[model samples]
Target: MSETFDVIVVGSGAAGMTAALRARDLGLQVLVVEKAHKYGGTSATSGGVAWIPNHGLGGSTDTREETLTYLDAVIKEPVNRERLEAYVDTGREMLGWLGGEGINMISMPWPDYFAELPGSRTDRSLVMPPWDGRQLGDKFPLVREQYPRFKLFNRYSMNLEETFTIAARAPGWKKKVATVIGRYWKDRSTRKMTKRDRLYVSGAALIGPLLARLDHKGVKIRLETKLETLITTGDKITGVTVSHLGRIYDIEARHAVVLCAGGFEWNQELRDRFYPVRTSIWWTSTPQGANTGDALIAAEKIGAATEHTAEGWWAPTMILPNRSASNFEEVHQAVFDVGRPYSVCVNRNGDRFVNEACSYDRFGAAMASDQLATGANTPCWLVFDAVFRQKFTAGGILPSAIMSDRSIPMDWWDHYIFKADSVAELARKIDLDPAKLEDVTRRMTEYAAKGEDPEFGRGSTIYDKTFGDPTCQPNPALGAICKAPFYAVQIHLGDLGTKGGLKADHKARVVDGSGNPIPGLYAAGNATGSPFGLNYPGAGGTIGPAMVFGYIAANDIASRATNRDVASAREPVAT
Candidate 1:
């Protein structure tokens, strides 16, 4: 006989774990099944910023329509306004709910994706409070492994302690490298320092706080438990088959099944089968354990309709050696933060691409054009002077630190960051038109001297400056390439995960291929086709929606089961 609960959640990514937490809160017995060895999933490996629209949280100016405009610019299809609105509606409400349950939110008012438009406002972006390592107890190892080895800080008060400690000692560029990581490592609320500590806040902060909340409630989190199949009868889902460590088991959810298994970005065959382009490499910044499209597939096998498969959570990336996504946090910071001499970014042809320092989307857009107009997939090249390369850290390009945390593993760059003495020689090593390389250098130098980008126009947008260092002299994008012993590395187009999958109604119930709801089944996070269409409004936006819908699915399931919505409740899919 199979065990059962009120709800069965597959995959413990942010959405899955969050759904389980919310379900338990609604008084539903919940079982969270994860295929990975740990909790966190892709969320563990991501920057923790949740791009949000206007929350009643003080200063956020983000609105529903501006968000839609942001989405339309990058996507290739129709935006499902009805379903998408539900996501927005829940975002503000649930965010407050989670905060009430001990999740900490810091208002930045700044646009996460760095939009400078009229509607763009700061402080609306919610940042999870930094969690104390002492609170995590046994989960500290899980937290450490989840984030790249970073320095610890006051988990709750992001500013009070961290900012004062830094400003008191490491003023100016003397600030620690970790402090330069954007919101990934710092606390944002206390307003302790005059200058914003660029410390980052990613899975460490986002997942950390949520995990802490779930811990407080004693949620049973099982790892290495892969959900195998959905038991259905007469169109209703009754239970799920699960396998762990060679053992098979069944767990029936009396109320519902919430599929939060992340998208199938790591599945090579799936990537090739569904993606528009055919390429050998796919280096999305997703967590290493992100191979669970099972939620989407299982639902589909049972006849769920879908949308948004044409695109994904994508960005431009540097193709480093040993073939991995470039350390973007490092890449962006190096070009803009380290105060290194200006550099120029170019493609394999040695010609310039998008604003080298702009957000990954613009970079991806230019590469997409190159792929469609010219058959180019491997967009490589990073031209830096000796000063820039010496001081700057370009994400995965630089080796990770070993002991004292000052340096990276030697193997990191040995695999990528092709090195040569001169522009012509470097072009030879990367294999591109030599004349084109030199000509690009000549033009870039001229542009840097004049301080303007004639091509893609890098520093033109306010969004461009959001990630750029205010210290650069010439336009951040127009820095001259005059420094000697210049180096260029190859970059690639990467997707965090496919945004396409099973289409679901606002309640997160899977809709059939015929556009009918599949009872007793629901999905959130990437497992369901994105409600955002191709539009990604901000950084944590994907995660924020996932968490919100996860909460909704849980309560809705419990509501129906308890007869709270007696009149509207339909019979379970499988009797």
Candidate 2:
């Protein structure tokens, strides 16, 4: 016998949880199945910002017309106006509903990645307030924690505000440090008893409240349940076949099956098939064994169409040798680390292709574009000076410690960090033309002195300055790499996750090749082609649409169910 549910939500990330919770609110029996041992997929490891336009949470003056206009400018080919409009219209309602359901949220003062674009606002992003993990009790163990690279001191997590406060020597530096240490100690004590970290912030905080709400409603979430395939009855998806503990089970969905199983980031075969160039699974920031394109592969078996398969939420990633005694390498997403002054990214010909201070997504796109054109930007070099080393941390390497540790026996400098006494020498070591690099460095030095980058306009925008050092003279992002002992590291084209998957409509229904909805089937998050196409609008661009579309799918299913009930009631009884 098969267990039945009104809706079966796959993947248990932000999108899956949102769909499940909305279905439960509408008095539907929803079952959430996750392939991983724990809930909270990639969303838990993210920055947890939701780019919700016209939300009014940030007290910004924005309108639907303005937001749509911006979308028109950013989104590329195969634009779905209906889905885009639906996202903008429902984003606020979704956030408001979540807030009413006890999820503490606050408007983030984050500028849009493309602040120069129309309708850009510094107030559209929203993030969760810091949460106490003890509130979750035993359930806290089931929640996926934030990535270790995102934490401070390998034990405590800090948000953007706290991170900047410590980095910039802000007014409350001492208090912030003390508070982080105090919380770490408290968490240590709790770990002894609960075996779980106590204080949750950032991505974990965003997901923790949603999990709490699900627990309150008595929703059944099955972990380590991998979806094998969708059970189709004629043209409609009726159920799913899942494997748990080496046992196969059939779970019937009475109304619909929502696929929030994420994108194909970790799938090498799919990456080779869809990506324009040769890309690897190691380039993504998604957790291991997650986002194997299960939803997309299953949907394709039923004639579901797809779009934007060649694109991703691209970002530059620094490739690091394994610090742990493991054989595999480590890749860290280069966010604010590249935006600090005294640093510049250059292609093989030693030329700056794009503004270094731009968003990571844009920077990656530029790398891809350069690769497509010259076939050389994938392994670009990030060059920085002694001034930047003294002031900022780059690619997880601390300059002060590295410079002082001369007694170490390993050839760490040769394998990872490249150092040279002159710009020409550094160019020679990195296999670049010494004359061209020298000329570029001299021009960059002059621009840094004037606080201007005439070639790319590096630090002229609010978004660029957001990640820059405010104490720097002239431009916060533009600094000449002229000091002795220059350093360089190779960066690759990487991403948070791939943006393409099964094609979905505004109602979050999976659509076929002819652009018709596949009845009883739906997709959200990275499981479907992103409505934004290739443009990443803000900090939380990925999650914001995932959540809004998840909500839309639930409401649409409930409405369909209500209509079916009314239609049956109107039928006459046969004698």
Candidate 3:
């Protein structure tokens, strides 16, 4: 830990650490500086699925052109084609490298969130390797011990749809009866349940192995080492100035400097300036320290150019009123994905605004109307009924794990999530323009009756199709959201982090305004613009790009260093 070596990485998240580890493998010394007093960075708290194409680990020879074709459909804009190709090519190479690093990769061959799109390969779009967490030693706190910076995590993922599905299948009368008994019993611990009752989510799966990989690397990670400034030499970067342990240290970069600090999701000032939604009441699945846009500011001091700083990774994310304190868990799969026999989500006008089954990314974009966020994107409601909430989940999720009140009770439910005895009363409570809601629901009922979608075109994306319930006849992802005594729950525009940042090339070299590489500087993960460009097709898509670029940057730095050593030895001392 005392010696400085070949590489000095700025953040210890997946990208930064991966870069450092790869550099070490290339026979280069590496040092990782972390600002949060932990080694995992944002990746420690991630879903951990790496979206890779044509993994070499499996000996797949999938063509690069096929990969590009798939990427083209997802990303509407012309991407840095070379950088994207590097992502796919190096992603495959990196997968094999992980094997040598003692990581066992696991692949799940399921439909992709964009399977409905072109070149959507249902075969292994994402993977997670079994890693040894014991290797982290005393630094495991930096890995598994830290929960949300603000909240406790004895709850489940509310954003996930399956929790609602389980809750809805419990039988309406059973849920009601259980609720009454739950009040009298006070502690349900008296009832015996299986460990399966405690769910394991995607985030936990990813964070575990990520820590293991760091432990195996023998890398010294200093948390709380905030990157304050970049040590620049004229137009090039030389070293870095970090404030760590209450003292500022001038550290030199022997190889390459990579910035993996996350995007500015929690910074209210930055969010207000760059993002579409303007609010101090932002809700995120990210940590509070995510406020630090150190990478953006630090790189800017030395004139680093970036891409699309206006919009973030926007998603039509849902949130509870004061329930922001906790994401209550319940089961509501039927409402959001199934289109079940009852219920539909409506906005303030009590009208259906988006395909209820759209991915959070696409759905969030469509929710940005002319009035909200100064004609940007604001929050909307997910409406349903007593029969539905008591039977299924509204918005198909329980923002957290436990609802203070399990049944339909408050008008907090109105704007938050409207529930009424009649369609008319629900309309009055939320101040909807009656004609529109009535007509919308009437048509919704007809569609549910036929088990088809027409309005917003639900079940169009592979993501929507994955949420489908095949047991209901046609597509489980499609149906008419029609059940009487409807309701609506409010959702906000939320994000894990923004994807737009310093543009990088195939080598993961930071690019300038004129599209030239910034020497001795590299960026990966959310600190750089997405390799997926503007399109985020599935879950883990972001994580895969982060890992791939991390490896590429490391390889580039190591190869150049080797060549530089050869050049320096041949030259005589000028002095």
TM-score-superior candidate, 1 or 2: 2
lDDT of 2 at 461: 96
Evaluated at residue 168, the lDDT of candidate 1 is: 23
Model 2: runs farther than 4 Å from truth? 168-171, 187-191, 194-196, 399-409, 562-575
lDDT of 2: 0.83
Specify the highest-lDDT model's number.
2
Instruction: Compose the digit string of candidate 1's lDDT tens values, residues 208-311.
Output: 66776666665666888887888886778888988999999888878788889888777766677776665433466566545647777777778887777755
Minimal lDDT window, size 10, model 3 = 190-199
In candidate 1, position 514 carries an lDDT of 77
- The reply for model 3, stretches above 4 Å from the true place, is 1-3, 56-62, 129-135, 144-201, 276-281, 321-341, 369-377, 386-415, 460-462, 479-485, 563-575
Native-to-model Cα distance after best TM-score fit, residue 357 in candidate 3, in Å: 0.9
Model 2 Cα lDDT, one tens digit per residue, 394-471: 765654533343532265575667778988888888899989888887888898899999999999999988788777
Ranking by lDDT: 2, 1, 3
Q: Which number leads on TM-score?
A: 2
Q: What local distance difference test score does each model get?
A: 0.63, 0.83, 0.61
- Give per-residue CA lDDT, model 3, range 400-441, as digits (tens): 233424543464554456566667677777777767667777
Give the TM-scores of the predictions, in the order they appear: 0.82, 0.95, 0.81
> Cα lDDT for residue 57, model 1?
69
Instruction: Find the 10 residues in a row with the least total lDDT in model 2.
Output: 566-575
